[model samples]
Target: MASIRISCLLMGLLTVFLGTEVHSYAASFGSLAHTASATATTTTRSVTTTTRVVRKRTWATQSSNKAFNINMLDMCHRYGYNVDGQFVVPEFMKLLNALNRAQCHMASEILYPRDYCLSIKDEDKVDLIVIGSGTAGSLLAAKLSDNRDLKVLLLEAGNLPLMTSEIPGLWADSIGTEMDWKYFAVADETFGQSLDGKKVNVIRGKCLGGTTAMNNMLYDRGLEKDYLYLESIGLTKWGWKYALKLYKKSEDCKFEKITTSKTVKNFHSQGGKVSVDSFRNTRTLGIRQSFSKAISSSNLKTVDYFDVKNHRGFVSSIAMIKNGLRLNAARAFLTDANRKYNLRVALKSTAKRLLFEDNKVVGVEFENSIGELIKVRVTEGVVLSAGPIGSPQLLLQSGIGPKSLLNSLAIPEVAVNERVGSNLQAHASFLGMIVSFETQPLKAYSISEMVYEYLLKQSGPLANIGLSSFTGFIDVNEDGTPDVQIHFYYYSEDDTVFMPSQLDAFNFNDNITEQIIDINENNDMEIVGISLLHPTNSGNVIIEKTDNGYKPVIKYGSLHEDDVTTLLKAIEWFKKVLTSEAFEKYGPKIVPLKIAGGPEPNVDSEEYWKYAIKHLTTMNVQMAGTCSIALNPSEGVVNQNLKVFGVENLWVADSSVIPRIFSTESSAPTLFVAEKANDIIKNQLGCKGSNESNEDDDENENN
Candidate 1:
């Protein structure tokens, strides 16, 4: 999107030249052409048709002095839509983006310019190389290097789990911090409201544990319907039954019953790496009653969906907690806790590209913390675990992308690719409020109160992260897969001050109890987050420039007609929720949530509602499907084992392998992918089989 302006300029200039040509023809033969008006009209129409090709939306233009390159032309041809032919778009995109560099891969060049290449000593060698330290890569490295068989190298651009605060839902803060990749969205009239009104942030975590450490740790095995849909789409083994088996193999849960339990999302196993527990930290009497009433009124009886055998009852959140501590993928995958004699976890190491020879992945190269260039050889294979943003770019850098794109970056073509970084998927989220005001909860939650409670025994406010657990489901469309999902969270603080409260206000209309005669009261708060899952959106991720070091440019490709319909439905549901009797009992004189943080339903104007919707929606951090893994090598980027389809000894082990979006956070899913992928690699190496690939793609691969 940031590059679209540059592209348009190029298109405009091309069109202008064509415009000049048309004028020249008309001006030169005006008298004769006018006399034979019909003939002139016919000629003009033919010329106009030829000239209109330049007017197509996808074309990219040049900067002040730079001219458009063929690679840019190619990018337009494949990736530029909203533009005409995509043949040129993907290439131009690569020029601006830089296809995924190899591990230790650098911008435009390999860590250094041409002048510096001659200075390097060629004796660098490592026994084993792991491209990423996130889910798949981390697990593979932990297992392969556990025997201290040889020196192992892992390269990662993101920050590691270096601090306590980095834990998920810790302070319920850090959503859009420096650790977030913060990608861009393709311009869309349907969801561009955020872009045009407020500079709302689109988040993707860039820290260690990668996105897993930051995602709301909801453990889901996906619905039966989801797998069925995948089967219909030509993918097997991913069906519900097989997926459930894998879920069972990788998970180890304590099975704590959730309170205020509406949906008991079942978890598997009793001794896995993650700590699955129902955090019964605290809940208010009033809020509890209100929630119960709300469920009964909605006729949505709470059910315990976690009984691997039978799912039917209300239970609490079965979170991935171990001894009250988070066991993220990085932690779980590491077999040895202390310094490894043969393994190296290179934190802050950003992978640039995969080194190849005659179409085989040899190793990876990257930039370390000091900004110094480094290279490591895989000897066997190079797997990409940089998630969606990083993986696709890596493919392009390896010359595995559209042919024309590599040329634009001046990158020599190594492989005239198939669908490497072509199909991308993602889901969008919004921070909205049904109501926001001082609550009886916060007043009692002072910092000193936490200190006092902790000093006595680590069992009070100090021990808890203020996020009240959430509930909802993968409600489906006619196709059976969930299209829309609604999650409700307890915002522990003031909403207006923390969120862009200018969005909805009517949901907070003042209400009164028998004790209080008047109804003009506000303070109790709640945030209702409506998400569009299984979105019909698709965007592209390409390598940009040589050394911006700002990660890749992933164009947000979501909010097609279906996605909007789902989002609108989610909104309608929220409105229904607020209108519930449970809501009425709560002292909000404001019967329902407000919009644009503006006037209550009294505003009644459609324009006001539209503005409110625009300000409230945004991108969530759960991104996947840049390097898809599937049974169909034709439609997928990776094979069943998570290895890249075209390149030998090359694989993508992160969230990128998920062929479509899931109805849940991507962290747990990636960890599962790593878990399963490790075993797959092990079997290939003649080792025993264990664990399994644990996740799903964004919601649209079936489409």
Candidate 2:
């Protein structure tokens, strides 16, 4: 009887959860959902409408929702819903289930609510197969598909992003959701000591837009020198001038300051797919202004991050957002019309391995949504855009890594590229350095009120991340290039409950988080992160085949002395900002974050900061260089053309091909690669399709 009750409870919970999800999507996509009253009125005999018209309308109204309802009922029945089954809390469950059913039923009537893309039939062949519709693949597939003559297939391991992802502030909510790949770095004793399980959560977006859908919407193109290293390494096309051109091509610069600036007028572009604009929330403008003043007071000029002449300064960030919605890579590139013919997307399809005919990649084998293994042939080639982690993991799984590892695993070696998963690099940032202010920087509002405000005006905290959008770059060593990037997030006094601790955004331990909450309850706090752009140490990714599938073993975070020294200098730089007249007015002071196994050290001492630096550093998730671009096979997995060595028609166009980690967010660079790859692939395919499209062009879009 107890077992039956437990089973019934779980079944009811599942129904409620799934039902709630459907309603939430409906609320987010208000324009899509149909009204039940309208449906009922249409069904009834209305004097205003003709009988024939009513019948036609009713027939046309039935959609995927009908199938969803049937499937939902079957799922409930299979989970132990029966007339004869004795269950506890029957009345409550029955009431809740009734409400949920009604809500879900209404939600089902919505048209193309989820990511509705063209499905791939078994054994189908395409001109090109772009694996992983991530940051790069999404754009690459769309660009390649523009020919309308060549069939392009884009495979995504995860489904479409939820409507909540459109809100910039809700980015953290998707970290562990179905949208996230949920890759965790191997636990390290040297760092992540205060986090849960001593492990750092490496967030990689699994959905159509890839990490672009789930990450903070900052749109930063690194310094010009960042790509000079690539040019110096024989990748001449990837020089600063060409890289900036590609960035401009992909960007629809909406910021008036950038679009109208005479000095930077040529640096930005219009009519691009990705919309770059300031955060929509007006409430944060005051705080950002204060920060800009504070930065000036610290003797650092406030310059445009996009200006070619500038290398170090504080500036209000521009993000991949327009109005109030996130313009992720998929949304920017893969439009519904694109799927009408040449372009097709297969969601929830995980590419297992590459199928090679001799030395050429001919096709791919992947697991479908229903756990069925299927093979799809490609006429042209395969582009591996599965990101730094996924790309390396797939390569190793296909026996393209070191021969010794493949031999031990008993997998046949496809190639002997020892560098397939080596040279992994990322920006390291310490998260524990914090500052408390005497007054609240910004007022905290309730979720319901914020939602209402956003729905009505499209302006609120939900539309932006407040002062967090203010980012800084510093040339710590006085070199021409910036070595450190500063990112700070503000927590309003009243935000103690609904903050990082509750969301587990950083995976901090309960004790450490609670300490933060205690401090934040009365005083507004700023968590300043100093990112080390250039690190001497590097790590690698290895894959092990499991009964389920291949699991990525990420051996990362061995910080070098140089990295630590740079971070120390950054700490001093930030301290000057705190002491500035603009910030000094707030009576700001450093408050070291509490760590486990501690009597806290003196907050002002260098020793205390060193300890904090050692324990608090975390990856910025701008990971790259696992399958670096080099001159030959011994040095890297891919060459300057991004083609894998010893293999024909197998290209990599993601961060995996980045020769070096740069001092900025990875999104823009990844997109630049996609733009470059589009041209390369077009040149290789001998297609004459143009890459440029107007913003209002209706031929293809992701919406």
Candidate 3:
């Protein structure tokens, strides 16, 4: 009877121990089986007895193992754990210790037993390979991949957009982060000098969707005359007729009560991939109505910005946003149908250089995600869609630019195109005026409340990009074409609650900051900015050899006298609108301009405005015209067909090939260029279902 009691006591103790172990395991990880089974086998020898206990754990699903394994590998790499193709106990213990130090609780190390450092082999050959999956490249890839007989490979230098990119109002937060190239231009004596005496930051998106992913979602198809000017300069194929068709083909405009004007109904297409709409249906914060009344008081009529026929009045700005989310180029063009079959996308792959065999383009060599060089062979051709600066830099790096530049850089010249990186242009803008209001609409709610509204209903102050609500185009030249674009938006002193880094991102000087602080200490403010649409000055983008790799040297040329003259006229026009009767209701007050270490200028003098222009002028990030199209190599880098001069099977289809700068944002025009390029490439390849005339077929028929 005493022996039986001792056995019962031992069993009770074992049960408590098992319960404690199971509880600890569950607490460290997630939910698991409530009971774990353990079997003990005992063997009695001459002098000793041995027992082996086997424990069984049941996982929720196979996907759980995969998820845990991925997390473990990520944690091991992040914490510097030595994972040399094996999952040993010491290495696992090191990972656990690091996780513990980081205050992270993880499941058992046995869950992730596979090696995570194994190499993956990708497809090496395709009919066509396009480098840089940006605004143009994404659409081009989708169109080219539509033909199942063709295999297309697209490579992007950056990864997919983060969750921050999906939020419409958090665009500025993405800039200068990993998603941006973060290029800085070489300071010019005329317009490049900022208040800090530093070069202006050239923010270019380095992600799959490119700049469209981070830009203020304005959906303006620049002035029609902008395209007509291109045709006048010898690019006859890029006339407004062709551009209009391409714009309609790509846009799916959703008209609502506020957006359904006669001009919008006639111009907007309904069945396209891209969704275009107005934020008035979502959130305008009453700024639209106030601005409309203000402009009207100054005798400026409110017209549709998309009228295409008229661009010289106030209009509600449209955006490339739908359902309160940013409709980026990737979402518009890179559909699942394209990826499911013939299209292959390589993200986080940097194109090192183009591969050539005796002047015939063959393949591309790029650095993959693992930092290993991978070569992708192209059977037909290779298209360079790496934007304005990147496209020129890649061409120069591949020995395809000017002979002199290539010789100086110790790169053998394959093509001597001197204009490969010349003629860079960007719109220059200046803050016209800042007006303080007694009370603002956006200041009514806290940032958390705005975010909550957006999360629940996808509508609120968070849905509006704070750049502008009402835009105005004016013909400073008086030559029938609008040469100045004005953007109007409200700026609450408390807006920093929503975007903490806004003031820093604005790159304001100390004097401007002090003025802003003084104004915000009392009341909210609104700002209006004017951009010179038709600047006569241009710039150039060159490459320099660096210790790490090739770096682009952007030279923004001196601002011309005419550019400043036009801005002066624009500022005068803005003053009239600011003092109109419409602002009387809001009791608007202008914040005086002050310069650091200098006397305050007379507000009405051109001299003072010029000082402000020099200190305040900045690029609106609408850079273009680097690798422009022309009749020959002497005049431009590529011909009207977008084929690189003196090179076969090489093409470029991006904003770089634009012959002239547009009077508005370049996103829509860039998309049009890519669509046109699709036709050009299809015709050249004689692919099935091509609507273009194939020269090869013509030759065959003649033979």
Candidate 4:
């Protein structure tokens, strides 16, 4: 019905333009012409004649000053609303109106404009209520609401995705914006010196798509062992054999270039919501080729890392980008079709606490957009997908955590689960590797050219996120499993000197910003870093009661001795790649490692490397295992079913339930968990939803 309205509006505008006289219109409109051929129909008896014209137009001038004209042209192309023949005043006005509406739809979000949930009465109740419109929440909400009979409510703390956030390359621009939660991890005393001995910023998307809308867009399903470890720990349903199916169910791999590997072909899926693809531009291709060659020359084979069976190799990084825009989880799952009926989404709604009747969750108390406290009842169940940090905090605030912690905060304990915030894990990283190259004038046009290219064609350097093209998963134990993950970042000659505003989403500190500027002043640079995929050391997420509300106290680091040794090996492997013959021509140089209260370390010394490991270790931002899934209440807050150990009808479907940090970025794995949890919840609820019509349900049931 919405599509019909758009088509009718477009057609009404096109008809008005085609009805005008050609010569006079072209003269007044400043060289506007239509290319489509016109056909005349005549009736013999009445001598009535009609002319049907198809409209088309081309740019008469090549000036960049034509903002209005360029934008209109871009909108027409983007929406496939072709204007074929002769332009007129009415048609022009209609085109302007259409463009304005599209722009407003992309730029603005419905916050408190009109409260959709306000109409619900005290007696009214939904079948399912999902908190947090993030990665897991969005997908689960969409799937659960597919059944027309089911009433599903989804709540988001932030508003919709902005037009700026939709741009793939402008990811960093949203870092400190209203879209991000902007939480910080407490500075690690041992390995957090590189962050200027200050708290490391942890960015989480507050909007509908969650972190999927803000992350680096790297699409990776961690090693098979990561999930197998979960199965070994009592989560028998989470092994790779079962988890891979969920991954395939959510992914729609529509890459331009496919790898020539049977395993990769079998692994990747098509016709799903999320788009998975590799960088295909010339610049990105060159970087990928060079990085792969370097890794290969260093005694590592180049293979498609997406293949779970053979993941140890260098390959071009895959991303959740489609047509140069971020295909976030919200866009992927919560489509217009899905939201048409049976689904109510509330934006800018923050959950204050969970409502419990004895041991079971009955509803949730939340603050609406205008700060009005509203309680929504749930008939079936409540799923808390409020991300790793928010999930545990909500649980603690609702008196579902440690008894001692609840008593300290003067909150009445509902359930004393000591492991609510323990078992926190994140990939430990060191971003000290910097390879400089001779400056080259790569582009013929100015920076404006790049911007225009992105605006008009959605191509050029701005198309890609500019993080890197290649990545490698390497084994440290000489076994088949990989313990270290490497990411290769490339910077153009201009990018190093004056950093682009688009990269602000990273929220780098002043020191790192200055370092980047200093390194790129005269030459282009490549920054490569390795992360310990399976760190034995873990951390905790504690809730410290504050004057306003509860703030998370994130205590994490590479503190384990095995973690240090593994990182040392990862650093050695990276150094080997840098010293390879393929990278020799680029004049690879390691940037001096700087620590807060120490001098620059000697690059070749083992003691210096260890110092770097201790002082320079950073969080990869792939946090998980806060509310780990385990059989014992002492070991985990959630059980194998992703439900809280002591709470009934309360489930956590986010990254917090992952028992361990995976060997790859947590985005894909997080998505996979969401997909799998949807089924788990549906089965537990015994509701035959519309998702059963899909092949995924059948495959999952069989598994």
Candidate 5:
């Protein structure tokens, strides 16, 4: 009884740390005799008494000892909890290992009351089929299934998200993990040639929540002008007003600053699916504030980026985080939907091709986890929300692309639409700039200490990227329009874990990685990531059938001269920031990395900056434009309603429909698109309470 009580107490604590998933199991063990004694001790040392209780009340149970053991093992491996015996005790380690070897299901029974997936028969038919349980698909499927009469099937290529994905700061660590699709850009001499193997990695989350599960959770709605450009380019109804309505409908803004700010109060809304909040407590708060101060000192206005009136300014970012955990699309939208009998989620199921009959998509063929092909027919329609890369690749697999390209691949052309895989645009940035500070403003904690703080209080350096939250949108062209988005990353001395992911994400060469590691080892460093909001060049995605499956071959355009100039201007803007009064006290200075086998140009010269920018250019993975939206079939793949031109009951709802690249991250915009798609889908299905857009509603509204 004593041993069971002790083990159960540990499991309870694990529940508290692991977020809402297994939180109920922890509460269930609150009745144990030993829990009271351990609770005070753990709470006093790691978490505030109030925070622990509040989290307990907010979360419910769903887990087992096996789940606990595995997740604990994951935590140990992921965050260096067992590194150098930092936080490990010999007896406690033995208990964990024993639990790992034991079979336990009762905790899981309580934690997860029911399985989310519903097994479907091979020839089964549903009212609607939604491919890809990504940011868009998750919400779209959830909303579609809300009508009890309609049956919705959501197929995901990957399984459910892991417990580690809940931690906000660990988002980067998942770049090359199992949860990521791990798509690498095909080698190009003219693009990303300086990087390792002349390749740049494209990150797409393979799990249920999709990229939202593995991404930096910054919720940027993009500039109002970006939407106007969409409207001008034939996406007539996707203007600022319609877009904002969808944005507010999907967002549940929890950011006190934004909610309270009179300037942007009306811009945000309450009680929506996606919870948006500010990083309320961060270890490097001082550094973030100092950088914001530096922006003001540089003569740039510091205002809420959410406010469209002052859209271009410096401010700490608002993220899709709730209660210190990552609230991904699945968590926010699909969790409750799991209980709905009308929705069936097929996890680890890859959609092979769309089954088309006379220009109508009637069904879909997918490969299940055990390598079996299953065909499911759709009665109402099929929506492809498989992201820009996946959706276009799938379309090409089903022979809906350029005829010449399809013929080259020996694929039977189902629908010849020349624009199926063209117009790929992504936000590229220069990661070579390193800013050094003489003294560190925040005290660095050991891995064990940081882990404890994260597990207990859910507040610390591990809780959020400190200086990274503070970003600036600067007007590089001096036209009063922001041209670049500046992202800042602070690395404390001797950080062994963080740099690997950063290097791997950009696929930086060994020489550059070594230089960065060396600089980080000696000095408190800030990596200046200057991202071009709009680029002159565009790329395309093509499919190459492999023994395993279809692989997307991204043909990114060569770097344009205008794009390079924009980055150069951004670097100049950053120079002003470093020299500002706020940074003077910290003695901030630029530390340039040597290019591998390049001309020895003066570091201060334009030629050197241009060379560096070219060598270091990489992407933010805000990929879009494939399967673009247009007024007609001659112009693009999809129409204003996001319906595929040549097919009936077929639509594309992901970032692939964005006709042009925008000035911010794509997640929030993707959610907005999904919200609009949901209403459109619901209205088509004759579902009650559908908030379909009215073109006349925005007629009297100001632009």
Candidate 6:
């Protein structure tokens, strides 16, 4: 009878103690058992207290052991333990891997002037018009708007930032909503195509923050030579010096508080504006050793490049974060202080066409907040930040494109038919493999009692941006210049590079998206992603079929042999990465990996693979090149300052105007155009930059 009573007590107690998807405070045998006890003995020197002992005992019931093994990301990363920037080190990639996706869904939607700021639009009037509220635009707008007289009109087509945006796991939600300007790429012969040719989607934020709000927030500036290439291609002012200024202007780097390089510590500012560090308590010894071996074997060095101009090494990734949250463009530009003044932010409104008088740009026609059609006449000037895809379409609708294409659309030929909408570029990204292992998910924070800490203490997993970190750079070409860049992001759960039906399943939003994740059911898992930059194949953006208005038709021109080579090279590299010692031992099994020793999946060969990849490959959605720049006005569509040739008071300051494409996030460069173009326009007008222009400024106004 006594034995039976003891067994009943043990059964009742075991049931009471269980670990949840998130940590639970209730005392249970899981932690007091094998794994937890072993970790405790090693981590905690000598046991002191006895009154509240761990209740050490190996339970006969296997249920608790099974539950304890579920989704251990919180426990594994040591989340809910640190304060003032203390965290775990080895599993940083796990955190970064989770950040690979851009989440477009919001728990709740906020209203703005346009459907969302997924695409860029011109706020192009002189000292005021702010183009793109993403990383750079927001900072510029907020700081510039500081001038009392400048009645800034901050425009974004995307939804405002939400509380959930601060949560790292739901990152993919940044891509789909009203904010994403889902531009499709023109189809090519490489990928499997529809009888009706398929275009890969190029998404941009139509919201105030622009892409910065949606991006993973890894701060990477490619090789210095990329800028020099710009000078060779028609952008003389965009050389290093000019580019450096913009970088300085946009960042208030806070390296002291971050777990990164001294160069980053010294070069970047913390107090200036955008909060830039989320890699605290990460960067473990295990991770460092693994990456060092992996990158080194690949013949790459690990060095700090943030402070130096020309750097090479595997440096820790920098971020634009604040208290473990993203400091997006809107946060920088659209401030509460500015909103109090005449700075009006209109959301959900898309600029349709530029209203013109003969050869002069007069104002802009647009669909308002409720999708109402309206016209805003700018007696001063009109700026075009409609990005690469939308801006060109806008110009064409406003009568500014190639004469041949315009004649085909039957739109009245307005601006002298120039080379607008020519050079389109972007990066191609692929999911690697989904890992299901006895591993932690990437949020991997290191704190004691993490869940409760985030819930009440306001310190824990919630305070960390989920990501595994980032790396890769422009590969050296035979000419001794780096030409392409790539990044490998490791996560605890993803399938970035699978087969066709698998690719569709991973890349698109299907019924799987509707199914909520049961974190409790998943543990010992990981995910990997690899991205290829500097795509060679150029595409075209034409006006969609319409008697009036300009809806764009995009083609994913990915047939260039050079692009095929780059994609294949990057894929091969990822295949090699999966075999590294650390991963081979602890990482999930990589099946059918195309590396040296792997079981054969179904198909092989360039022709078969090209067909597979072409149909499989899609743009990272970093779209650019439509209204290209030219040193000689006759050589390109827009002039050096991105002004449409022979047009009066009209300019395009977005990716579309970039004459040549560089390999990095395109938004940063696009914002730089807005920055420099604003100054150039002011100089041309000979006006002291301000919203209310001087009498002399009137002459410079387009009309």
- lDDT-wise, the better of 4 and 6 is 4
lDDT by residue (1-703, candidate 3, tens digit) is 2223323322332233222222332132223213233343311111122433222221211122332222545434443322243434464455345433322111110010111111324437788988877778988888888888888888888877654565676667677788889887887656534443446778788987888888878878787678778878878777766666677677888756324764445556777877888776334535556667777754557764555666778777788887777778887787563334677887778888888888888888887888888877889999999999999999999998878899999988888888989999888877636778865544354333443355445566667776464678887677877888887555555344322234334555544644554555456776667888867878899999998579999987677888888988888877777677766666776665776544475667788778777767777778888889999889998888889988889999999998778878888888888888988898889888776421222111100
lDDT string, candidate 4, 378-418, tens digits: 88889999988899989998998988899999877889988
Per-residue accuracy of model 1 over 30-129 as CA lDDT, tens digit each: 2221100111211110222221111111111112234534453543433344223223434434433321221112111101001122222233566566
Name the top TM-score candidate: 5
The C-alpha stretches of model 4 lying farther than 4 A from their native spots are 1-124, 256-263, 337-339, 439-445, 496-512, 593-596, 689-703
Q: On a 0 to 100 scale, what is the lDDT of residue 294 in model 3?
A: 71
Give residue 203's error in model 1 in angstroms. Answer: 2.8
Better of 3 and 5 by TM-score: 5
Which of the two candidates, 1 or 5, achieves a greater lDDT against the reference?
Answer: 5
What is candidate 6's lDDT per residue for 358-457, written digit by digit as tens? Answer: 8887776666666666555555465666667767877888777778887887878786555676667666654433444455424443222332233232
Inter-residue clash pairs, candidate 5: 24-60, 24-61, 61-111, 62-111, 62-112, 63-107, 63-108, 63-111, 64-107, 64-108
The candidate with the higher TM-score, 2 or 5, is: 5
Question: Tell me, what's the RMSD of every candidate?
Answer: 21.8, 13.9, 17.4, 13.0, 10.3, 13.7
| Best by the lDDT measure | 5
Per-candidate TM vs. native?
Answer: 0.70, 0.81, 0.79, 0.80, 0.84, 0.71
Once fitted onto the true fold, the runs of candidate 5 whose alpha carbons sit more than 4 angstroms away are 1-118, 695-703
Count of residue pairs whose backbone atoms collide, per candidate: 91, 3, 0, 11, 10, 104
Give the CA lDDT, 0 to 100, for residue 93 in model 6: 37
Which scores greater on lDDT, model 3 or model 5?
5
How many pairs of residues in model 4 come into backbone collision? Answer: 11
Query: After superposition, which runs of candidate 2 have C-alpha atoms over 4 Å from their true positions?
Result: 1-119, 496-498, 501-503, 690-703
- Predicted structure 3: clash tally: 0
